[model samples]
Target: MQVLRPQTSGNVDRVLDCHGNKVVLISRRRVFSLTAGCATFLAAPYLSLRQSRASDAIELPEVRGGGKIRIGLLWSLTGHLSVIEKPSRDVALYWIDEVNKSGGVGGYQIEPVIMDAKSDLKTYRSAIMTLMRDEHVLATFGGYLSVSRRAVMPLVTENRGVFYYPTCYEGRECWQHIVCTGPLPNQHSLDLIPYMVRNYGPSAYFVGSNYIWARESSRNAIEWLTQAGGQLLGEKYVPLGQDNFDVICKDIKNKRPDWIFSTVVSDSDIFFRKEYARQGLSSDRVPIASLTTSELEVKKLGVSYGEGHILSAPYFQSLGGATNAQFVDRFLGSRFGESGVTHFNMEETYLAFLYFKKSVERVLQENGHVPLTPENVRAFSGGLHLSNEESPEGEVHLDPDNLNSWLKPKIGRFNGLGQIELLWQSSEKVSPKPYLLYPERGVCLSDGLHLPNGTIVKAAS
Candidate 1:
């Protein structure tokens, strides 16, 4: 019943009252590049229907005695990461809304405890602590950067709470308490590096944000690059939110690598692409190939900034297929339409919720009325499969051993038409290898992880 004033931050627009919870509105500047008339025609009824459903749900009392199932949503909603992470959070909410509309999850209405980490590590820790101890959520989802993930890993593990990470990361470790739906290094670069080497030249340069994700992902890139007989011309890791890429641009110009592999994220990603283009580096000859860049960044930086550039991901907004077409249309018509496009991060978050919902349903069916504890949810989530219609990105499977999704890898190039054109994709889903280098540490056990030689390292309880 309390209407708070709008936040003046550049990352957020006005807040809406969804029942008692506040949902952040998207800014007008981020709308899709479609024609005004077409966009309005497509989006109007969708928005109206969504708003009406939200109202009906809010007005209605609890239909089932299952009550509310609380979960935590952590993201940097007002800092450097707001651009991508906000949409990611919105996608999670989107799936949550759909779940509630369809009779709730296992007869329980879901309630989310949303918090902003502000792109700060300390804030991530504090928020997870509150979600764990105070909110006591069944599971928490969100974390764009590796450092933020590391900041909250121990807390989630120690408390035995579930955490779902939705972005591609440097896959090095897998914990029993966390579920990673994003593609790992092997899932992405296993084919990407060889494809680049075959089509482009054999020399590459690396640029990324200074953190565990960039450092570890670059390490995997180098491993694959070396295996492909490619040379590493140079490498650099800048701090997050660092906009100026002049020095790095100069180095790239001098080194003249055949391709540039970028791991920079958020606002920094937009700045890097703009600076690289401003330096007169043509994507045709010395294109920038990235694991982190997506349609969201390209939309913000302008379609021209991404023309001819290569990107590897599990999903892209421009992907063809009836399911993907419907997915994109729904996104373009939703309250979060300001995002303009659906990318890997948002899609993976949607997949995570799907996984959660299916797992909870299975658990309920088997147990016949039991508490949806973190352990029960985690136990059933592994080795789950989702059909093509259910998942926008074809069919996907979650590996039982590693708790990471067996994702279909894809390579795409941004064209002048403001969309990424698919170039290559795995014939089938690729199993995730979190520890790409050390296979022994890849498998997960109840007590602990496996050793290099398949020996189980039991956890001390």
Candidate 2:
């Protein structure tokens, strides 16, 4: 019902709701590259029916191997979502390349038939359908935002597709088809907020994008703050792709809450950090805490803009184990090159890809062959016991009862070099409870949200 207006300035285009939330859109050049180090090409193999059927259908380079395993990837590389999605794409390619070099899941080369949804919900919905109905992918790994995942859930469920969604989100669903490899509310909001209430103060402000992830996360934030005996100062939802945070930042400055919690994603996350700096707010004054601001966004904003901020997630580039150090060096060399930075979301997706790879192996080992079918893929994933050592994160195992993984939780502070400095870590791996039942002071009673651990009371939402 709302018509989007073209932007008069800047490269990214966006549609704004009357209340100031962004709707993402992309241009039509139609070229895609799997990784930044690779060559760009028209992704003909993953094209829509119209594009692939046209007389001038593009030809792709031939693979030298037999029985290549096709997996679908849906990410936004050219739209506003690209800010967050590009790194995930690069990591996916690099990780897959490594897997192939090491024999690749029962000797089948992993070929990701990549599709750029370009931040359009319709494109995401149709793309998942296309991958299933047309490409017949064995399994799929992508969808960074909650909205994108929500778009494809029904299709994935109805058609029996195995979708690995790797992002910290509002924990409100328990879809059987999706294996969430990121932290839920108990792992993040409940853990981080109580820490804030004890260390920072009781009063806090809430800021986020006007979407399901933000809305739901903020609602969970309210419940946790109240349970922890903290008071709400204010709450605001800004346009997702909005370039200016002057209005929201000014409100927070006036309120002077002990801390500001944010769920702003993609470009808006970076914008708000810079604006907060410009507003002269210091960590000692009113700290900014976020579930969405990760090493990727911190790298983009730089330490000048991103420093002193706090992030709560399952992994950070600075977690510094022998495994983490090796992964960081190798991944940085292959993709980032000059910028030695990565984030929780990128690592989470990388872990998701590894889970899929492990599942393929499990299916093959048990059934004698890996079938390129959704039922087979789901069964394999449903029974997998993924090792955390293979991942930079420590001791990860997927829950068969729920599709999410038991992951370690950590809080980090960004430094001058665009890296997360580790602050605190959970005592052990936390269970994945997608439907959060909150927790009690560091121990999960009902479910730390397919999460998350701590003695958090179940969320009111």
Candidate 3:
């Protein structure tokens, strides 16, 4: 394994020699260049799309006379990621239908331009171009994987388009064109690692899919684990569709770590969880704690295989309260029916549209009958808050600084019925520390995170 050493370059901290891969960690205040691969791809399609479709004074579709505000919904409807992405697409469609029922946003009915990227990078590239060029969508929402997000991000930025990303991702990015409604590592790992260490033990084994989201999330998990005085047993990353974990489970059983930190997502997660149980292991002994497993996966894996494993997410379908109750009822009554159990991704997907609606209304209210464009909506969207009435998660705040949401962090385990039974929850919403925002001295061992402007906010215990 190549040891990566952090070196200061200007104001950025660059990690060198991580298996010959350069990792650039950007600060909260500054913007960093996209990856070389992303830059190269952008040089061709990104420019051509911007030049051909974008203009200095972009024409706004008139709300009157059958004019519709075309909103793009790009997701994997038929692929490995379809299990997760399709639910989000359904939520987006549900939100669109709900908005239109209420007379739409700012006197315009949303015309959805939906595309299935088929979980392929090349498909994502072409599909996003279709949304931006041919369909001329006002804003696009999709991307479950970090690679998919990175694939079309340059295009989104170059065209000055808006993208409401709903997946909880590995942070270190602050994009002006993206509104991230999902939690970051600080939201998931910070609260989850310590809780696991305290209850389970001070030793862990990391297993994740071989992808940017899993690798980077695991990297942060290790940092948080070390800070809490926990020991790492071993760490492994497997290919995306890797179904066999016989060797990995054998190693885990031999090492006998207190807990397994899993960043494995999608269909692979189901297989891994079942394989863990099939190895004569139980979560009561060595639980597979995950950031990605939700009601969606739990249902597929069944209660026998999924129960006792822990999950950390902002929202769960089984949560009690009138707000969540109403949200659940509405979704269950929808075309998706009971089978479409709401998860973290779907909740955030719905919240994205809520924010979009509020952002558009605010723009129209302040500017007074002005034409709605992606730029204006983007300008008004930062730092938007939704109350418990509007949000099922009680309260949500989109951080103006980083374009990420301040989310309520909750940890839970699957019950007998394949639903999340809440274990621990923050007293209030935890602020987003997408860039880590650790103190200059060292990693903060407590729940408190040091912000860029010198404010240290304490997370709920």
Q: Estimate each model's TM-score.
A: 0.85, 0.80, 0.83
Residue 306 in candidate 1, Cα distance off native in Å: 0.5
- Best-fitting candidate, scored by TM-score: 1
Per-residue CA lDDT of model 1 for 1-461, tens digit only, reads 12366664554344544544444432222222111222242233223223222222221111123667777889878777789898988787776766777788888877766777776655776677667665567888999877667667666665667899988887767577788889989988778887899899999999998766788888888888999999999999887788999999999999889999899888999888888888888898699889878888888888899899999999988877898888778766866566878888998998899898888888888887766687788889888998898888889988887688998999999999768899999897898877668664546555467676766653211
In candidate 3, which residue pairs clash?
none
246-292 per-residue lDDT for model 3 (tens digits): 99999999999999999998888988888888889898889989998
**Cα lDDT of model 2 by residue, 212-324, tens digit:** 78888888889889999999989998765778899888999899899999899888888888888898887768888998787777667767667777888888888867888
If both were scored by lDDT, which would come out higher, candidate 2 or candidate 3? Answer: 3
TM-score of candidate 2 against the unseen true structure: 0.80
From the highest lDDT down, the ranking of the candidates is: 3, 1, 2
Clash count for each candidate, listed in order shown:
0, 21, 0
Q: What is the Å distance of residue 180 in model 1 from its true position?
A: 0.5
Per-model CA lDDT versus the true structure? 0.77, 0.71, 0.77
Query: Regarding lDDT, does 1 or 2 come out ahead?
Result: 1
Cα deviation in Å at residue 40, candidate 3? 10
- Alpha carbon lDDT at 432, candidate 1: 84
